[model samples]
Target: MTPRFAITDAEIATVVAEFYAVARTHPGLGPVFAAHVTDWPAHEAKITRFWKNAIQFDRSYDGNPLQVHRDATDVRAGMFDVWLGLFDSVLRRQLPPETAAAWSTLAHRIGRGLRFGLTPQNGGPPDLRGPAR
Candidate 1:
């Protein structure tokens, strides 16, 4: 899909609000977010800022996303997929087609990075690891 100029903060806020509403209730994600995020409003604003930085290169956000997810002991591998799924659904519902696709692509990539960073690396399975001991 073609890029539509740059997404605005208002659009960012809308996406954050609508997406988190779904996330805050998603079966795989609800408990994780509930456990980590106590203040919804503040969390929404932080997410908006994060997206603003991502979509607009505004550099208004300063939080460490990797560390934040790493710190969330409740974060799990499949949860990122759930997060991305909900984000894509909400963005598609609320925004233009190109805008939704672009943001969803970004979210999916970020989700992959988070999933990788968050999942524990206990060496690999026997098959994936070097010859068995």
Candidate 2:
């Protein structure tokens, strides 16, 4: 089933552009991200594909985001928080309330999963499960 509130590619691009603009304004992340994304056209295309897969569930993206993030060692912890905050702000400004909520939830889950590896036992099993009942 299609979502009632769907965001288009143009919308995603707008959000991403705004996000990069915000990053550029911030001293902590601006220099690092700008240096890494020296090739603006290529970086934009990659990010566009990434977000397309994220919001639209496109199957073409087979990249490992965890590995990518790990490779970007220059991305400090605080930068992640700032990035999320900027994303949330953009979603709130651009998307419908329901869409924004859903996207925020998804972003949070992805962030958590990336920061802390997901467990195969489903969150390490419930404490009250009593040793696999």
Candidate 3:
């Protein structure tokens, strides 16, 4: 059988819905995220566009994710972990095991990279990684 490279819009919608539900239930990050994403419809539209472009190369998205997340400032290190966990949960619930694993791996790497880039180097908040002795 040929490998299936396509994911349906319904699958994407399910994942997104599950993701938001998890985010809303997350301990520390939930309230902050809910407050920030007040415009659910707009946020959903943007996110849908993002995923569509990501998986299908349909260049309909036009937002700077790095800049937006950087400006959010509330997306701390632990929050990244929570976000990834939710993403993994949604993928697992909606897709085949192998597909979920692959997607989760990619999402984890991207999330980690984004978090690392967003973290600022300063004496303000103690460095995430301690200095060498």
20-68: candidate 3 lDDT, tens digit per residue: 8778887777887886898877787788777666665668899876678
Clashing pairs in 3: none
lDDT: which candidate is best?
A: 1
- The TM-score between candidate 2 and the true structure equals 0.75
Rank list by TM-score: 1, 3, 2
Candidate 2 regions exceeding 4 Å error are: 1-5, 117-133
lDDT of all predictions: 0.76, 0.68, 0.71
Q: How much does each candidate deviate from the true structure in C-alpha RMSD? A: 8.0, 6.5, 7.4
TM-score of each: 0.84, 0.75, 0.80
Candidate 1 lDDT over 12-41, as tens digits, reads 899899988888777777888899999999
Candidate 2 residues 1-133, lDDT tens each? 3432488888778777777777777787788887677877666667777777776766556677666666777755445667788779988997788878877876765666555533333442222211231
Residue 96 of model 1, lDDT score: 92
**What range of 10 consecutive residues in model 1 has the weakest lDDT sum?**
123-132
| Candidate 3 or 2, higher lDDT | 3
TM-score winner between 2 and 3, please give it.
3
Best by TM-score: 1
Candidate 3 segments whose C-alpha is farther than 4 A from its true place? 1-4, 122-133
